[model samples]
Target: MKPPTVFMGEMTNREVEAFLVDHQTVIVPTGSTEQHGPHGPLLTDVFVPQEVARRVAPRVGALVAPSINYGLSYPHVGFTGVVNLRIPTFMAVVEDVAASLATAGFTRIVFLNGHYDNTYAIAYACANAADRLPAGVRAFPINYWDGMTADEAGEFFGPTTGLHANRGETSAVMAINPDLVDLDHANAELPPFPAVTNAPAVHTAFFFSTPGSVHRASQSGTWGDAREASVAYGERYLSVVADATVRMLDDVERTFGAMPAR
Candidate 1:
């Protein structure tokens, strides 16, 4: 059987109304427009999450809204292609998008995030919009990497991986669009991991507060070794991310079911 049109932008108004009759869930991809080292494209943050949404939407009987391409990228400001949105602006965009979907009758909305800096903004937007959302409409903002399990993480990132435009992200993008990856320019920049890598409070504060720190840490804007990245590794990363997203959708369905017929 042919698959339903999962992209919201592709459907006619009537088709959308009909599709929503059966599927009350929607996925939104949120990403940043910024530098991702030399090998990764400036669009990496947008591409990875959007592609994950596209791949997972069909399995969960959901529609994928158009991507929120610009995000909070202050840390990467020194880079040539980096573009950063103010926190309020980024959060407002996400809130309005999710609220619109909720008003349109989607009871479950998921924001699949790509950029490291965009996480809090997306979550804040969803959380703040909750009270205004129609009854039973729930919004969740989650990172695409959250889908990777410990074992999967070992396979994808592990000891060799660095943060930012390192192995994992480069590989994920390569899987999505090999043409976008320029491995010849791939480089590694491993900064000293903070002494306590497991302190949530400390890490959270550091991640949120330090934007210029990227400049101080690595000249290449890279965190890990991308030389280890490969098409096969990228495919594996994507499969895990998509599978994880589908599982999340399943949980949403199991907990919320579909909205009562209008």
Candidate 2:
């Protein structure tokens, strides 16, 4: 017999009801539609977490829920084909999604995040929805990047490159589809001017945190160099993230026990 479907989208209402018989967990992957430099696809944020969630759910005995494709990504909005929701709007959406899952009887709703900008919004939204959740039903978010070690991430992205459309991310996109990324046209970029320096004026980490900072800092829309990105590294990154996510989900299950009967 074929293995059971892992994606909720592919399951019918009855299938989902059947799943709930033994499973209370569901992975909701969230990503953004933003420019990821010239080499990376606009959906780079979408693809990464979706892949990791799928890779993780079977091991964790969870189903992968449909993803949230838009996010609070104003920083990359200046580029072509970018769409960003206002912070309040994104938070509202996140809360609604979580609340919906809770109502649907999914006791453990995990928002697996792929975008940097969606971090606070997801966390705050989940927390905000807590009052509405039925007792024992829980919803929360986790960044996929957090699954990797600093040293491991540093290996793929290098120290100077922030998480943007850089080596690590581009490689991930390549792993999903090599044709989607154009290595020949790829460029190595860094924050211009004082951003590259240790000047006290520029707090290096938050330099690109401001809205529209990505556009103002680099015309190519890349926060770091894509020159070093490789499909090999992408596959490895995916494997590492997948394994780590499995362990993380294990911890989540152990930490939060069972949900009440819905």
Winner by lDDT: 2
Q: Can you tell me which runs of candidate 2 are displaced by over 4 Å?
A: 1-3, 193-209, 253-262
Candidate 1 segments whose C-alpha is farther than 4 A from its true place: 1-4, 158-160, 194-201, 252-262
Total backbone collisions, model 1? 1
TM-score of each: 0.89, 0.89
Model 2, span 1-262: residue lDDT tens = 5457899998888999999999889999999998888888888998999999988988878999999999988877678998989889999999998999888889999999999778878999999999999997879888886767777777755537755888888898899889999898888777765434665346435543577777887888877788988889899989998887877776776766555544
Q: How many residue pairs clash in each candidate?
A: 1, 0
Worst 10 residues of 2 by lDDT: 199-208
State the weakest 10-residue window (summed lDDT) of model 1: 153-162
